[model samples]
Target: SSLGHHDIIEYLLNHDADPTITSIKNLTPYDLAKDKETRNVFRRYMAEHMDKWNWSNAHVPIEKSESTSSASKKNGSSISGKSLDSSSSLIGLPAEMRTRIERERRARAAEVRLNAMQNRGTPKPLTLPSIGNVICNVCEKSLVGLVPFEICELKFCSTVCVKNYRDREST
Candidate 1:
């Protein structure tokens, strides 16, 4: 019997509260479950402790089964074939989840490879083409017009190239 305080209901159950005890509404705590989540919680708790409640068809813990032992033996043999140290990182995740993650990783790697291959051997437009043969001093490439510095009469293709050359010389 509760006013929907699920935590209090759980605490009462943990402390040996009688499940059959009814409230003024003539409803036991299990009967008073107002929502699906609460009902599911109650069902799972009852399933886990069915033996303690003297219930018929009690579920045995899965870890104590013979199938688990055989499955573990198979897993151990399979694990031995791989690098044990590398497998430790993903030990907690399920096989399907890990496979999905690996697939995504491979997809990203392939995308990057494709982008690199597409860009390979393609000439990048670093600067606009020059109209005359006035060459830049820094890159030795023809500039639209010589950008002359009075100090050394140095010419550059662009302002960006001239600034980079000046920065390097200053350092």
Candidate 2:
């Protein structure tokens, strides 16, 4: 949602939060989503429960996610943790390096999920990484709306940079 509280947002969606319900400003939940991941939550739900909600009336913008297909996990609460898309942020790294980066990413996500599961007594606010404003070390391009492609203490704009950095380190 607008607040980017993934846990609360997912809970509401799972519990039948109506994305079609618009605000006074005429913004639906998808419209108010602060980032890609938040929108993914809505996309995942609409994909799994196609008949449960009137999606066409929800005003979801087209191409917001790849979850439009029937990628339903059969009553799964979080489908994202299971796999990464082909266009993952770590695309530029070598196979071994990509594997390492993905493991790190998955570990971070798993930690967040565990925290959310444990805090079921009350809805607690969660904060995600703020790597959007940082520029890539190699290309100097802004990383906004892009993945926080990283390795060790270094962050890069792309996997190629990560590979280039590693190569530079060796030679």
Candidate 3:
């Protein structure tokens, strides 16, 4: 007789019905699943039989897999009108604040690029009346073009001068 239902197929398989048992036409039940739906139904029946056979075994406890829990965690409990993850888990922002932050970041980047361009190459040494040679404020030595410094209303010849001048100004 042709297997018409999943329960019968599962029951027969569980009782050790030979999977190799072929019909007179030389086809097994697995071979008769010619379409996707029929194949899926047959697959489910096979799974049920496996489950029953596993249950009959003495050793295995058969713990449920965490796949269901993980799925529920991702989907959240919104469907059940309960809290899922906290609202703090989501990205929080008003449109204006987001736009302003982006704008400020762009402005800072542009300023950095401008400063880099201005600072490129060797800096020119500053000349002064007291020292015909450009002088360093900290060491009081002749400053070279290698280091540049700016003070209030005066340009200095070395980084030492710039730092010392600023330190003096702060006090």
Candidate 4:
């Protein structure tokens, strides 16, 4: 959801909405909200009906760097106040856990660097095959080095034409 419906959220809270519900990403309503505006709105509604919440509900403690601005401060309670970079307690964490996370991060960085290096290499020039005539499925134009689309052995002249063809099929 885009999180745009303020009135509906207010009504839902009034009728007993659970702010602690964990999303697919394991984020609470307080975590998923992108900005201070939505956080404040949720906080205000929650304050108005604090009795409905089960304060004892266990929520996964998110890392401080992942905390949103408003939810990480104000309202007398902050989920995560400090940046994860400043968290020295990671040194005390079990070696396997720290090593695993560090390894994964390093691997991802290595992959990204590899991809960057590959992209930096010269791009091979697209060549027209000598065998057959390649024609655009949408505009029926002759295809050169690149065709906009390649559906099922079919080619399109441009991105616009490919989208138009898809829309035509859907409608």
Candidate 5:
């Protein structure tokens, strides 16, 4: 949602958010890219992780090159003038304007990161944890599936974690 913000876009992509998803207007993430660099971030990601996703569905341009920055500046867009004004022209703006844009980018990135973290909510058991292999909601330890142990829909790796969860809730 943080359009024009490369870091935020990268973060969302890294977290497995679908990039090819379209808005009501049928605009894709590539369609919403605010600058050549931002578009390149998507391209680079697709290049780095080839088998991870169907990049054709990503809708980003396939022009993979280091000279894309200069090319976009010269041509205004990779889509052969189909796209409108991009932030690539921002290079000609005054220093203060560039600084303001930078501030806005950072603010937007922070807002996106916060939203992403908040949306994750509680850990879903069996779904990979953020760090190590954790399937337990309490201790966050990887559970042995030989036996099922659950309380109120929460899974635990051990009885100790269950006890700890109950003890904390009672306090």
Candidate 6:
């Protein structure tokens, strides 16, 4: 949750609210503390009560109510075991963890696609083959697959070659 008020945080801490509870970004109240005052408040609270905080109790098991179980049966969901509640399943996960998981999944998919493309063989490079007999001004090589650049009708192999030629002329 976005922590804006130090007094409210302190009040919550004084009661029984878990200070270690993280938001979707995996940021706790301490992490979200923006101002020096808020940070100091969190720091002080942590210093005093850090040992008392029960790490195991952080994840409270969600007990399926009778009504929910009966409703699931009526809906004819053949899936066995406790019904998965999307929101409840994510209740313990920090937002940062979720984002990281999603990013990793996308990266893996991209890697698979890249591997598939690679296995299909290298794509043909664009060339000015039709132009014929055009040589790179700098390298003095045939511009086969390499694109030719024209600076005042003087052909070069690439922009880099053109820049190099220009630099040489300027010197």
Point to the candidate with the largest TM-score: 5
- Candidate 4 global CA lDDT score: 0.53
Q: Per-residue CA lDDT of candidate 3, range 80-148, in tens?
A: 422354232222657664555456445546545634643573333334455476645433345555454
> Cα lDDT for residue 124, model 1?
30
Top-lDDT structure, candidate number: 5
Candidate 4 ranges with C-alpha deviation above 4 Å = 55-171
Per-residue lDDT tens digits of candidate 5, residues 57-171?
A: 5555333345645766576575663334445545566987666655655555654664465358653454443544436666444565535478877787768777877886687
Q: What TM-score, over all chains together, does every model reach?
A: 0.29, 0.36, 0.23, 0.31, 0.37, 0.30
lDDT (tens digit, per residue) of candidate 2 on 12-64: 98888878898743457886889888887777777778778776456442222
Q: Any residue pairs clashing in model 5, and if so which? A: none
**Preferred candidate (TM-score higher): 5 or 6:** 5
TM-score attained by model 3: 0.23
Error of 5 at 93 (Å): 40
Tens-digit lDDT track for model 4 on 5-116? 6666667767777867875434466556655565556766555554667422312122322234454354434335433442342446588756654664555465456446
Instruction: Please count the clashing residue pairs in each candidate, in the order shown.
Output: 0, 0, 0, 0, 0, 1
How close is each model in CA RMSD to the real structure?
25.3, 17.0, 30.7, 14.0, 16.6, 19.6
The order of the candidates by lDDT, greatest first, is 5, 2, 6, 4, 1, 3
Encode model 1's per-residue lDDT on 1-171: one tens digit a residue. Answer: 336677776777788776656554234566567764555455556766664562211111111134544555666743533323434434566997566545644554654564464357432323323444544544445554455442355556667666766786777
Model 6 residue 46 CA deviation in Å = 1.8
Positional deviation of 112 in candidate 4, in angstroms? 21
Which prediction has more favorable TM-score, 1 or 4?
Answer: 4
Residue 169 lDDT (model 2)? 63
Q: For candidate 1, give the lDDT.
A: 0.51
What is the lDDT of every predicted structure here? 0.51, 0.61, 0.47, 0.53, 0.64, 0.57
Worst 10 residues of 1 by lDDT: 55-64
